[model samples]
Target chain A: MKLVPLADRVVLKQLEAEETTKSGIILTSSAQEKPQEAEIVAVGPGGVIDGKEVKMNVEVGQKVIYSRYAGSEVKLDGKEYIVVRQNDILAIVED
Target chain B: MKLVPLADRVVLKQLEAEETTKSGIILTSSAQEKPQEAEIVAVGPGGVIDGKEVKMNVEVGQKVIYSRYAGSEVKLDGKEYIVVRQNDILAIVED
Candidate 1:
């Protein structure tokens, strides 16, 4: 089943890690760092949350940088996803 | 200087841990659990935060239960305190 976030939550799919350095040196899997970048998989319909009015600013397919250790991990359909509040998303990645 | 919370933040001082159980059994320091109970030391004047209008619902001197691992620890004047948002408080304790 697909994930449907509620309230101010947003579903995100993390981007793959860069295994190579700028100098074209390949790094091992253990040396790769968990990337903070992700793509919006599902956008929650923003309304009132915790007695405060909230509005969704990002859309599906938009790349974003989220706060470290901010969201919960969910495994669905053999794929991993993250569910976080809209505020946890720090910024939208441009280009 | 005393902590003055900003926005909907609240400063809390954790209550002392109970060293003895209700059964009159005294527990060692390592066996004692960190208490979730705290006394409200300061309350912020609620306003718009993250583009959402918020109103403060808590006041100083109130005893409350806060969420675990929710807020940041701050040290002021050699005193330790936790600074958390209003929503991080789970419930008010009445005695």
Candidate 2:
């Protein structure tokens, strides 16, 4: 099963955050910073929000950055995903 | 001094958070949820970010909602401001 966002929400899959330092010792989970980067798995259809015309600019399969501590966490089919509004998406990454 | 957001950055002044309960007792700062609503003070001239062209839809003097735990904190002239990318803005509040 996949997530489909409604309104301006988007579902993202977290990218692997480097847990090891140059010395190759893995840091404890509590010592590591929260991951902020993700790959867009699904995007919501943009529409009117608070009577304002809102549009979605990000597309599926795009790599995006967001605030590390933001967004609601969801666990689906044993996979973790983040659900956030369009505005929480900082930027779309590109080559 | 006023803040000028470069690129898609936005400067916002946080709204007052209610710390008192119905019993008229005040809660500690740590007990209060992080402010997620703000008034747009200055908006960046949105342009290309991460090779994607972005546009600013929120205008000055507009109330907006954002991720509570996100954004970089800035203090200027005895006032506090939050600087976030345009995408970090969740929604524009209506009248």
For residues B1-95, write the lDDT of model 2, one tens digit per residue: 78889988899988665511221222111121232556899999987777666766778897665555558989999999999887677555443
Record all residue pairs in model 2 with backbone atoms less than 3 Å apart, i.e. clashing: A87-B87, A87-B88
What interface RMSD does each of the candidate structures achieve?
Answer: 14.9, 13.2
Q: What is the TM-score of each candidate against the true structure?
A: 0.45, 0.47
Candidate 1 residue-wise lDDT, B1-95, digit = tens: 35556557788887755622322433233333233677899887767777668899998998887763446554334456666779888788775
Which TM-score does chain B of candidate 1 obtain? Answer: 0.79
Error of 1 at A21 (Å): 7.0
* lDDT tens readout by residue for model 1, A12-53: 997665511221222111111222556899999988787777
Which residue runs of candidate 2 sit more than 4 Å off their true CA positions?
A1-7, A10-95, B18-35
Candidate 2 chain B has its poorest 10 consecutive residues by lDDT at B23-32
Q: Candidate 2 at B89: error in angstroms?
A: 0.8
| DockQ, Cα level, model 1 | 0.03
- Top-TM-score candidate index: 2
Q: Model 1 compared with the native: what TM-score?
A: 0.45
